[model samples]
Target: MSAARPRVLYVTDLAYPARGRRYGDEDVFLTSRLREHFDLALCHPLDATALMDAYDAVVIRNSGPVLGYQKEYDAFRARALGSGARVYNPLSGKADMAGKQYLLDLSAAGFPVIPTVDRAEHLHQLPAAERYVVKPKAGADSLGLRILPADGLAKLAGLADGTVLIQPCVDFAYEVSFYFVDDDFQYALYAPDPERRWELRPYAATAADLEFARHFIDWNGLDHGIQRVDACRAPDGELLLVELEDLNPYLSLDALPEEARDAFVTALTASLSRFVHAAQGTQEARETLIPA
Candidate 1:
């Protein structure tokens, strides 16, 4: 059973009823492959904080939106970070790992992202459009996402400024997602029809597309973890950032060719191995400094 292998506590909800996506099936396939290299154990997200201490690292996979269990997720994050518990994504993400705040930040920084604003005063900065998208800062998987007319800003006065994000509802050609593992480009997929966001097909990313995706990956500065850079083809034939999913981004492995899926699994195994070993080394170094 390879007792020498590093053990991983894979956190995922096998039965999560995700709309338009089969979270369970993807995790089931990923876990089956991941088990080949790591001594793996599966547990639901709620139980992760309790079970994680015994494993080399905890991998947060398709656990569904954090909004469903915000309190529990907060506790888990606090405990993991407080104890230096090795999390695959490492709790160091500046994008969705934290929240959608990066979207606003990136927009203001002139990154090729859909223009976003949180306050009514910033309305001048966004392009005039018939509708706007209002989503919670902590939202995921389109949860709490709503489209409203341009005048809907008045309805949000009761909520705190940073609690919601406002962006012009764009008329884009299609959406594409670039998947990465530890800063390495794995594959790209696109939804041919915007209506079916999850009906994905393999996409051949051009060099410019890859360059656009890598910019956010490099900006994120994470040494390890999976990230999905989602963008839309604007009417101007340019890709604009939609979301930087650095925390538990779905890989859409079912949509990939067998060889691509195998390659991703291999890359993930190596990343996890390196993450665990580096964490172990750090622990050992700290122990060495203790006065015995």
Candidate 2:
């Protein structure tokens, strides 16, 4: 941390044309709010590595899909890890940050996720459905996603190589997402209409809903940063995990009430403060213990 306040390098892609969402607007709002607590600078994802070293921590917001610049992202990740730079959402995430492998792992472990299988042989593992969803393991923003008929399994034999993920197409009623900052629940929003995923409305989360979301957050084990747990209301009324978005999960702030949005910003500000201070403390301790 700086002697006065933490310096945050906020990574975002202001011009990325996200479907039905204003990536620039939300980030503009968030950084404006965060500026109250930190010395902040905004940068595009492609420029993150070159600029990251000057800041105490890097906050990756709506940076858009890594598929657009995988090599640059890989380089940023390598440099951040090697230099011990504090990255919000920490680079240790096991979910979407790492890849779609977590969905397969969670499904196999019977974690209430949509049953997923990666290979032709594993097709029998998923629940029977007329159609299935197949997507690349490393893809994001629904890129490379496909809905295929059951008979199309032959074409997916390459899935055995672990480059892709397949799940039974869930006939869900609606989708809801729970937002959290450092393992604490912040707010939730749901899309009442299944077709309009980005048309969200504020959701009154129940105890059961919080319980469902908390399980994955606890499993993720991130001591700091924001996370979003996306789940769908299955036909039987159970909430099955759709995606655990730990990397730059877009918070539909526009759908939230004023009070709720303010509260989320407060929560994030405090979380970042704690995260930066902790990293600073560790560094100070190391310096103290070093032989002078």
Candidate 3:
């Protein structure tokens, strides 16, 4: 008899029309590959909570912005944590998984992150720029983001009760993202042109670049799952942390070479297997503790 394959509920929003990326296409390709190892079923984010109980684990991937279904997402999170349901990414991400606050925290801590301040009173902390980027603390996919001149800074004061983030508009040369699976570094992609953020090409990261990107991954402390370290090369030739996406980061698998893509899939498959085995151990431990 064959061993039973673990069942995975892959959560995604197939209809989410992302600005420059095809969320549906990526998820479709990923789910197809994942089916080789697990009995995978795809579901929209809203249905995850209901369907998750039937699966061995829930894999949240390109589920679209939580802003679209914050209530339902919160409910799903609460249920998963409360019930001890296995969730890939483990629901313990300290970066974007929680919110944008990490940017400010990292900035204050003097990491290589772009300087971020949430309160208008702290506006002086930011360098003088003709414009400042104002975004919600809980924002994603650039939703609810705005650029305002210095004169408009005071108006944003009342809205900063841990609800918004402010940063000087950076005049960066380009943006690059480093992809990782578990603690292993994978390939990287970069947007050569600032206007075309999603027009990515293969990026050759140097030793220093890898070190910079790995710092946040180590800081996030996720034992398994995917992560993207987004950074921008300033005009002065220094990379500043733009965002640490440890949530449902869109992997630009299309940009990687065949061998690199295959390597990523292999790493991810191993990570998922480890995650399933660990979850099974936890379940068994709990069952052992239960009274007969």
Best by lDDT: 2
lDDT by residue for model 1 (52-135), tens: 889989999998888899999999999998988889898999999899989999999999999998886777788988888889
- Model 3 CA deviation exceeding 4 Å by range: 1-3, 156-161, 285-292
> In terms of TM-score, which candidate is strongest?
2
Error in Å for residue 152 of model 1: 4.6
- Could you give candidate 2's per-residue lDDT for residues 145-255 as a string of tens digits? 999887887776666567888888999999999999998999999999999999999999999999999999999998898999999999999999999999999999999
Cα-lDDT of candidate 3? 0.90
lDDT of 3 by residue, 1-292 (tens): 0148999999999999998888999899888899999999999999999998988889999999998899999999999999888898889999999998899999999999889998867877998888888899999999999988778867767656668898889999999999999989988999999999999999999999999999999999999899999999987899999999987999988888888888888999999999998878777899999999
Which residue pairs in candidate 2 have backbone atoms (N, alpha carbon, C) closer than 3 angstroms, thus clashing? none
Candidate 1: misplaced stretches above 4 Å? 1-3, 151-160
Candidate 2's error at 284, in angstroms? 1.8
Which stretches in model 2 have alpha-carbon errors above 4 Å? 157-161
Error of 3 at 173 (Å): 0.7
Query: What does each candidate score in C-alpha RMSD?
Result: 1.9, 1.2, 1.9
Clashing pairs in 1: none
The superposed Cα distance between candidate 3 and the true structure at residue 289, in angstroms, equals: 5.5
What lDDT score is found at residue 34 in candidate 1? 88
